[model samples]
Target: MRKWTGGMLILALATVLFLSYNFIGKEPHKQTAYDFFHPSNTSLAMGSSSHAKSQQRIREKPHLIDVQGLDDLYLSLNMSEEESRSLLVWAQMRPLLSRSDALPDTVEGIKEAATAWKELLSVVSDTRNISDDDPGWKDCPHTVTSFNGNLSSNGNILHIPCGLIEDSSITVIGIPDAKQGSFQIQLQSSQVLGEAIPNVILNYAVHLPGDNVTDEPAVIQNTWSNDLGWGKEEICPDHRSNHSIKVDGFVKCNALVIRSSTEVNVNVSHPVNHQSTNNISVGSGHMSVNFPFVEGNAFTATLWAGVEGFHMTVNGRHETSFAYREKFEPWMVNDVKLEGGLQLMSALAKGLPYSGYLTSVLDIEHLKAPPVLKKRILMFIGVFSTGNNFERRMALRRSWMQYDAVRSGNVAVRFFIGLHKNLQVNLELWKEAQAFGDIQLMPFVDYYSLLSLKTISICIMGTKILSAKYVMKTDDDAFVRIDVIISNLKGMVPDGLLYGLISFESSPQRENDNKWYISSEEWAHDSYPPWAHGPGYIISRDIAKFIVQGHQQRDLQFFKLEDVAVGIWVEQFKKQGRKVQYISDEKFYNAGCETNYTLAHYQNPRMVLCLWETLQKEHEPNCCE
Candidate 1:
């Protein structure tokens, strides 16, 4: 019994071993799973209907071929045979197969079987080649051409020629499937021709200088013979590019020369018909020549002569000679001699054929006339007063008053009064008003009164009451050049008008004291009209009368600063349609001791005295001498 049981076990084990070896060693049947699951295969099919459904699902609804992956698969299939083969091999080798160890004979079957083998070899190769220097060869040409196979480094569609493989037979073995689409290609070349040159046409016009004759057009023609032939247009396109066309010729006058033994001053007149209206002077020669040619223009010539009597010939033609027997009168020449001489030349050259070296001469006289003279007078003189003291100011005043009494001159002068006395008076008033609770009114009243008094005093005394053309009022300490002031005023502004040193308003600040302030009531107006400051300024005769008359109507009040008061009064007059002109050049109260100032104010007494002396020596030298 034991032996029989052991034999059965041994036979069963041997049978299992034989079946396993055959299954492992034999090539897989060429039939795919679909053949076994087909509805027509009944012997091996149990639940064949269900199996058919499973096979349909695997073929028609493949889960492995998702939308994204199917796109790549389709693109691979559409590639060239070599490219398709390469892709299929790469995809198959990416994942190992369970059943096949050897490749298949058919293209599709071979690709499927080779996938597992290729994947294994690729893993081993990648692992062996990996190193610190290359980091697994991330930027390898294989991968770059795979995913971005159609794109260049600059992100443009790449156009690769199959012919390039002849030189370098490199192939990308593994790659991501390419996107499927219709691609466009554009080819271009890199050579160009230069721009063509253009044709140019030049037009020219000519004129004669110092002659009022209108130019007459002259046609210049050139004809070339076959022997001296000009080249064709193509050969000499720019033939006249730098060539100049010059017209040169001469005009002749049949003039007669007069000769005498003594220095007989003779005047010869041509008949009206043969007269050359253009005048030419005779200077100890057979003919007086005049060349009337402009630069690049036409030329003309005139002829005359001075002598007692002489014969003249033009181009080998003879003219009659004359003799001066009586004393010559320049106004009345011998008409019979003149007519005979002109007629002889006209008859000789009436139709004669001649050219080259044409010359002529005529008798003429040098007539002398008396010289004429022109006179100039002092049309206008502007006076500006200088000197500070009441006596000196009066002297200037009296001198001007007398000068006006004689010549009625226009004058303007200014006076400089120190602000110390006014400031002292203002302080006293402020102290007095403070005791009465009127301190706020003190500053306004003192400043307003002080300004009004200074301006009104000048208007009354400094200007001519009625006769002056213009009057300028300026400070006594100012250095002024009356001549320069008059000349500049005559050139720039000639009218009798008031002028001033102008100022524009900027930020308001008081440097005298922190307590000083200006109320809104003081500068309520949006803008101040232009007016002259009293330090140095001008007043026209008409406006001077208005200001003087305005003061007469009421007693003039005082203001601390004369300029501000003048601005206020001028503003009043401006409202009445009278305007003040601002003079920017005439600097007023320029704060320098040695500058060439038009006017300098508030200077030291010693400097002012020295300036007066220097100006008298420099400008009034005649008076000092």
Candidate 2:
């Protein structure tokens, strides 16, 4: 001991501390449900607060014990695992499960939590039968009641999920005290027959006086989803026109319409009944198609009852504008019917199962976007993706994306994906968003031709929502050398400018049948002004704000060719005598890796991994350090 060296002194101290923790941490073991899932390490009693029967209750409801970080603290003095798990599920179920006031520590409460999770999970795949035991199920005012002998052989009321009926039935959802001009119905569907995509209708009606089987004007019908858009790729069977879409709807004055308003051209906009023939629904028909029901996807359809008529959003993007055809008081309208042979996975009012207490497919809030942006985010590399591009997004996540600069919050890198009509992809996207918390799901339909709108949407989100000062919009297939980008951005004067390998005098594609094709009708201008290629580009916060704020509903004349559209915005700004600087940096190459580069694009997953290796080798010191 007197002759102890540095290593010897460290060993002596380690022995003392280890013994102290072992002996001082002495506590009798108690029953803990948390330890049953993940055994605690602090050496507590095996029987402290832990009961075998209480643990069994928690095992029945596995979803409740998933509360993260519950293992960090010991069971606070006699807090039983059954009570803790019960409380966690109780709090979550207030909004998620039944609205019933479930009391804790009682066996009934535990059963409620178990039943809620079991029912929620069971109906996700097939919403066929809901429990009749919950008294609240059959009593809600907004509950759907079957009428007109739709399924009278089974029961006057349709099964909670309305069964797998081949024909659309006359079912009424009762809304109580519904005297508000604003009402919302959250719709989710897991299975939609391919044959029913064109004729699904949701007509809103109010409970008026005198309805013993024949008083007209008794129902104020706010028709939603009449003559909406559908993909032409399935009908046409051509890859080039694979991007082709069609809008089939019926509108007299305020008939429902869903069409792209930004992409200028009949082939692009496809609007039927609105002012811009290019931007709204058109055609005379009886049946109104509401939601695009893909076979396996679970999508959120939000329809709001407004004074004018109704406003709807498929995910979050503005879907379509419908004016009111019926003159009844808007606030009094409550009941919404599933007409036009519509199939549904779920229909919930105020998030409660509305179809006579049918099971919810899944909590709609599970897909809600996470809070990603922090106050001091210096820059963002926004990767534009679609619902289907899972591989490319994952490659970026593993390679250069896992950097200290990104993890430390100096550079916030995220992928922005648009919703696809394919329900399977949307469901996966929702789960991915939950896992990474780096994904922003825009509720716009992901058409390959609408890439420019996607770019504009991300730009708007970056500048306005995320408060990112500098943003680099790239594809899922692209990779940015984060260290170098952070270095370059640190020295630049950041505003009113776009940076990339700029192209000047690039002529617009006039071909009629190509992805990049532009018709003279869509754009009268001969040659496009110098614009950055779409693979990658950079912009300051001001430039991002300028493009988004100025371009609204075809305001900047958004052509589907996103890069060209951006160039158009830059040219317009220059004409207005505003500073529109184009920083032409060759280092921002469009393909593969280089010895010294700011960014690279169109690289596959394997190449990205190798490029990240090379990027690390090319020594660049941290500029901030």
Candidate 3:
């Protein structure tokens, strides 16, 4: 038809210009004010009730500038210069139009306020030719005024003020400047002390003593005051802010201004009895001092007065003397009785000052003695009593072997008795001398001749008493040092062999009862024989008569650990060629406690009273006087 009606009128004019450009670029429908004060849109524009009384008279208008004085110029800095030339002549009579423009409801609003007063005089002549410094002039004289108005033809409203000057020269306009880079400055005030004191003073003085009291002048009183409040006519004993002073009932006083500071210190707290009355003096009115009686009763003074670059006046005073007097005594040991060992040998001769020949061999009258022993040694102590304190273990083994054989002038001790309910002269529980002694009480002896006569009567009285050239045996809590065991065995083995302490093995079958067990199958025949354990054993005297003539044809038996039955009779006298030696040089168990042993064993009675107080305090001399 006419080219399809011009292609259907160009597709209906491109769908009506794309629906009018998507309805004018969408994004707007947000009306509410209750849909513009709906009463159904005021009754659909109220069939015109005078257009709903002119829209409720423009929503009851009446806000004529009162934006709550725009939060008082945040922090003013006193501005001025005639309120900055009347806010640059009110922003040069404002008028850059466009605030929906319609405010000229009159004489063209005076040509839009004369073209905003020529553009606020070209922004105050470009803020006075900007060369910096001039944050609106500050030398205090505040100002910050602003104003805007249009309110109709599309709203507008601003107005800030904050201008000050007043001291009655009147200016004051404060309150305004609702933020957005606002300004103002100036502040000052603080000094306190009732504005630096002008009236408050006090001073006093007093002294009395022409050899004791009364010369009149002495009643100085103003007890106390702090932050002022009492006596001396409501504060004034020299501005009574009392620092301290109290003098009551006296016996000592020579001079006293009791309280007047600038610099003073007199403290002598009592202790000098020459019949009381001391002295002190200062002047500017009554003086005559002599303070010196310090024996006991009480004294104190410290004054540091004032006036010199201001403030300083301390005072503390006190003086009491109830007629002083003191005397006491009693403690004298007549200059250290007996010159206490000549003052510990003159403090070890001035700390060891012996220059040569050991100072004549430490002169104890040129010492000489210890070195003499021509045989005569016999120490034997063997007690195996079977319980109930056998006569308190034979009177503690005959009083410590007659006090170590009369303090070792060649020892000689003996005791070989073991009666634990007899086991037939216990000779080694027989079984060909059950390899020797009651091998740990053979299953607790149910009598086998009471373990063969207590093991062949202790192996024939321990080989006829360890045959003596130096025999020891032991056990009454063995403790023998008979002069360091006969002076270390006549000075280190002076003839033949035999010392003691040998324990190759025999800790009683790691003991833990089987009546004090001892079973490695009764020491499974020989594994450690060179022995020594019979509560401290020692020998020599011809190996104690060859073990008492080899226990006269062995038969009696009973060990019960007599040092592993004397190490199986010294391993059967070393297969009869006689040689049982293993004395790792003496020191047999100080199982007692403290030691350096020449011999020791069970020791008790508190280790013989701590080895008789560690040998009378290690060799007498006022042994712990």
Candidate 4:
């Protein structure tokens, strides 16, 4: 009996030991805020042993001190310890990892940074294996063409469901408010969220005579975009010029206004020439007919999209025709806004093309399959994007990604996006990621303040994964001509090339209200290092590797401005006795589109499609028509 009891005890002990080793003694499954959005195919689960080894290696280093400022930075970001450490391990300081004072000096801090670095690498490394298969196509439903409405008051807005096209015409019947000095009719594109102002495709203003008796009425026409601000004004009937208005192929005033009769006692002071007096029509002959637009005038104006530009006919007479600017294409105008002194009675738009008619030629749905990275790439373009910018991403895919370089896998492009605050958006983004296979999901909440992390992510992708000869960082709203850029890069030296619209002397914005604001606490310098504009910039593979390795070794510096941060890194690389060629070319347009631009920034989705179409048809660099 004693032997049997002992045997039972040993069996129970052995069973308990096996259970403990299998479950209890092992690590718990880690949960992240983004786990629900992350697909199982990707590496959401962490590898503890790898992180442990990394932490051990970091802890072995001496002369490490605790960085309290970095702790505060992590707090300010409102990220968990793991995320904060991951960011620090990715890039030190707020933006770069170059500040020795900001480096983790203590064993605990070092381990945190190192562990975070390993986790980030593990998550983003999966981007290389993303499926490149094309998602099957789906047909789009029909869309509206014409819009009509009345502008009842100042600042009244009307929607054009389908933007304008050739032969599209808009007619407005309104009376100018006499008390107001000026009124404006504007054609506006769809407003984007982050843009400070909506793009104005056309700005038509009519200024009435001032209080001064010598003042004359004026008419002006122009175009405006958020990036370019405003184009040259096409003013009519200059007060200094002949009363007969002439603006070569643009403006001609043939308006007739009945002059107001004011009785003036002649007193017979001088004998007025009978012939001259007869020259004046039936009454007091001061005809206010030179300017087409006037105060208190009930006028019917029709504006139509024509071959060259937009033509305006006021009261059945052609008043003006404004030449088309580079990027303000007729189809880009999505809505009309009426402002100022006009009381609009009715508005009507006709002959507008159906929504898909203009863009159907793109055949975005039936686009070619996404290119697989089979060989070494000449360039890897990492676009910084947000989770909800679905249209923008699709536009890029349909437009520039169709280039031969990208189609042949000589160039690779991927969007780096972080998790969205909204779960629905995250789900959609995940679906998009699965469908496109061109997006790399960063494991963090997306914010403008965290954009520097995206820059680091780009370098990580370009060097650690795709192994491209050059890495270029650009925005989703930009249009990049891959072939042109590649041709530009051909003659250049391969190593340490930093190419873009370079800014040689730019001061750091100190005011808190500025968009690119940097507090003295963040950067104690007066001017930023020579850096390329953020809209588009390129660096050689070696520089990209230095950025990646610098973060891994805890030596790179951090700056809030990504472009300026890159400049800081390149400066550090130069300090290491390496040569860096800073190629500042104007062809990389930092603002809106220009003639023969290599890359144009702030282009809307429609404009992107238009640019691509123009490039293909013309076989040259041309702005969107």
Candidate 5:
């Protein structure tokens, strides 16, 4: 009886011991306020994620830190360290115009703030051209990004999804600290400016040390949601508050805790409830400056940690630096934490300076072009039309487009249409599409703002499916000198093809009443990259492929203006080491046709008839002259 009892006791003890070991060692799964948006704080979920895929490559995010008081930093760096520090202080505080007495809350003050922001942005944007020695100078790789964050590992490399990472906020990337000197990270922010108000902080727990100082980070990232105003209680808990006072929900403090590097914008905001602490002591590093923030502006911020401290630059401007808070250690910091509104486009944790390349195959549209055809000077004219614009479509077909050659197997001409909200209009468009087979209607509405999307579909059809050597995107109101254009196509090269009235460095219209009012929300940049004027532009097959691929990768930001969007693609290709040969000659007139005209814009039916008849009578003279 005693022996049996003893055996039972031992077994029970063993079972209890096993249970205790498992229970005591594991951490509980707790969701905090920060975790709702920032999943990077948690263990990386190995399988499928509920979040949508990542949309950026290493460099699509543009726009960087505000250059407030860096006047001498540019024109001349001859200023003393005291002068430099003073300027830096002023630059840091300019964005806090919402709070500072220097910037009173009034229309004049707001206008002044806006102007200051514009000037600061100008410095950051143009600094690269100033000199290689200037901080923040970087050559934009400027290609489309295709790796949406849904990743799969194939033993050797990790594969991501096939869309843009538009919705993702934090992308926590862990870097292997193999060497002590390893400390360089380069990434481009997406071009989408999240909120019109530039009040937010994009915090980076730059050097997340895996040390004995509690694994829980000292601060949660301030993901000031547009829905939630900037409130101090959540982002920087009471335990985290130090310098800036929280007015309403906006949190402001002028101090630094040297944990890492990332741009933090001080803008109008919202709130949350949390604890705070002020245990760490670091002096003189204050937060200031807010520049015009635009989403989808591809800005690059590169952080390099040296033996002294963390040195940083944004798009080639030497932005800021921070010395070691505690001390630099190889085994200390291993991962990067990105918090806030940014679509974390690229994260490079390589401590050593290294090079990497991105190659993508992005195509998403189908056109029923001839599968097999002998080599010919083929060209397709995709005229953007509307359901209500039936008159315009018929007028075009009966006028200049009536050329029998356009109906040939070698050259395909089609009208691209979009659905109207009215069912009758939609049904009529579908019927038209089925009957003519020349009308390609899309699933989207026929709104003028979404022309860029329509253009994407056309390029896909022209380049990937049609196999055309040349394609032209013209408006329904334009008349093309097709007979002359074909003659010129014979001598054109197979690549680097672009022909249009080029627009160079056009300024964004700030006047709201104007048809072209480009709010900072739409595009934050002062001037746009040189783009071809929209009414008509000729693209070679290769250029078409590049443009569509870039858009698919979400590298090309979609603007309301279709021509400007295409121009953005052209600029991106230029950054990618490809060049578009644009013919800015007045003969490729953006307005009504000149006597020597390859194309005529805003042509009515009468104008089209006149143009076709006149060109034919000219004995095939060079219209390009």
Candidate 6:
């Protein structure tokens, strides 16, 4: 075995040198019309006749086949020259290559497999002609440290150029209108160039107790996105905390009360009896408390960015704290908007980030030539992104992609982006692709339904192009710990490995009203196979190769959910008498950031940079503060 391995190693070295001179040294291989094979439909309901015709049509164009490359591939797989030659001969005679472990029995099957592989190999790079030139990038630094302004009818707006950082505070002095019943203070995201409206990071609303004697003042805080409206509200004097009171006779409810120089508390009282005996003290001592806001009464409120969330202090007393929500980071809050029935006296912001340098310590010199593809990569990361997510991509480049493993070429990262319908977006995307050599542009237009194609493309790149040992699929919004993931993979089986935050018992979303609705026609199964969350997951090379081969041969069933499709393929591979190891780790946070996470998902651009900064400063796997 040692002699055979030694001979194969030598043969592999020789083949690499030849291929390096011919292929690697030359310009990147431009994709051709036949390079990409778009599936007709995502479902496998099509007849065998059409499938066979499609296979035959694809096999007719076998000019891209590199028979010598097959020999090299087999040699690299630790096969001796004689064994490699035998396999090649058998592959040509095989009837068809249907599965990963199934070897061709006849010469025809071998030829079909080789043809499919060669076609897969033909997809080297994006076909669109784009230059590799640096597009000029300029820094937009925020020099304004403070802003003080009086309220207008529009409710004074104070713009935060570089957004807030830790300990950043905004103070407002306003009086609730006597005639109005409610007022709102909002921390909002800056409107993007093409976006119709900005996102509301935090909406703090106060409903006043007006002429209605039965009504009591209430405070509610929540987040809102332009895509998906308002999130769950976390109100002051939390209803969940009012478990002490029963609603049978004298119903007792809690209300948040703040004093100018005393501790804040939730005062519980029985409204029907107006009894002081029912009053429950939440602060230091049992004392009468009052609401901070009063009709036509002036008040001072300060909102400070904290490590966990945003903390609000009314009249020098802590009132409420809203824990940051997923996709809503403090740094994304670029504008303080006061609306509703408030007469703002003045507003002031302090300790906000003044420059990008304070937030992201991105080395521009290193970006000129990012460490990528110098040698065989341990893992290939394909981040799914849209054409307009330039900021997200840039954040990734500046953050986790700067890790030693990635910079040293142990891990290669690429953004798998699809074209946009808008010409201007496509133009900007082209420029970005040209500037950054890490983008893998797909041929099809970007659509939520077509995401499966990008996953297949990642497999192709990982197996046929980079020949990585493991292939990981994640989103551009996620932060991946490359060294930690590599360390984890080291202790696990190297083949048929599907590692991530796996979901074992999940059913398809049959509801048509949902975004992830899976119709019975698209998927016949009642329960989906165990699969990792879509945000991040890893699979070994054998499984990736199988997926690529299955895709090329048109044997793999396409699913709209890319991660589930991978699960289906992995399950099939396991059925082929291969030992499949499913490693489920909770550290792979699919929903939001957490301490010591393997991969934190649903992060915005600001959070990505923050995560990186925290990791660097602390030298530990800590989420963004």
Name the top lDDT candidate: 6
CA lDDT of each prediction against the hidden true structure: 0.29, 0.45, 0.30, 0.63, 0.45, 0.64
Could you give the C-alpha RMSD of every candidate to the true structure, in order shown?
52.9, 26.1, 52.9, 21.4, 29.6, 19.6
Give lDDT tens digits, candidate 4, residues 1-625. Answer: 9999999999999999899767544553543212211224323224563543211111111224444334432433334443332232233333332234331222223333343334333433454322223233211212222233434444666666545655678888888874654677788865544565667787777656544443444556777666665566665543333444232244433334323343222111111211001011122324345466666667999988764578888888787767665446565566787766677787777765432222334553444335555667899898987655666787888899888888787888888775443332443454455445677765444435556667878888777766799999999989998887888899999998899999989888886534467887566678877899999999999999888776555556456678898988887777676899999999888768899888998787789999989888888778874
Error of 1 at 529 (Å): 3.5
The whole-model C-alpha lDDT of candidate 2 against the native structure comes to: 0.45
Clashes of each: 27, 26, 64, 12, 58, 15
lDDT of 2 by residue, 166-256 (tens): 1112212322221221122212222223333221122332221122212111112222322343222111111123232322121211222
What's the distance in Å from true for residue 505, model 3?
A: 21
Per-residue alpha-carbon lDDT of candidate 5 for residues 1-625, written as tens digits (9 for 90 to 100): 9999999999999998888667433343554212221234324333366754443222222222343332322343443443232122122222222221111112232332244333433543453543434454321121222322312121011111111111111122333221211112212111123444322222222222122222222222232224344233222212344534332122332133232332223232232321111123222322223211122345565545332334444555443433322112111222232323233445533322101110121210122222235454377678887554544565566556656556455676777764443332333343344334567654333445556656766776676656677878888778776776777767767577777778886988897534456787666669887777777778888778876665444334556678887776666666566666775645566666667677777665556666656656865422221
Instruction: Please tell me which model should have the higher lDDT, number 1 or number 5.
Output: 5
TM-score of each: 0.28, 0.43, 0.17, 0.47, 0.40, 0.50
Error of 6 at 289 (Å): 5.7
Residues 218-254 of candidate 1: C-alpha lDDT, one tens digit per residue: 1111111112221111101111223231111111111
Winning model by TM-score = 6
Which parts of model 5 have CA positions greater than 4 angstroms off? 1-377, 614-625
lDDT of 6 by residue, 1-625 (tens): 9999999999999999899766544442433222332232223223353543233122223222333223422323443443232122122212122222221121222332244333322321333322223233223233333333344445567776546655679888888874554677888875644566677888887766455533445677777776666676655554445444322221122344522222334332212211111112222323224777778788999988764578777888777777665457665667788766777777788775432331244555575325554557789898998655667788898888988888888888888875443333444554455455677655444545657767877887787767798999999879998889999988998998999999999999997534467887666669988999999999999999888776566555567778888888887777666789999999999878888898998787789999889888898877765
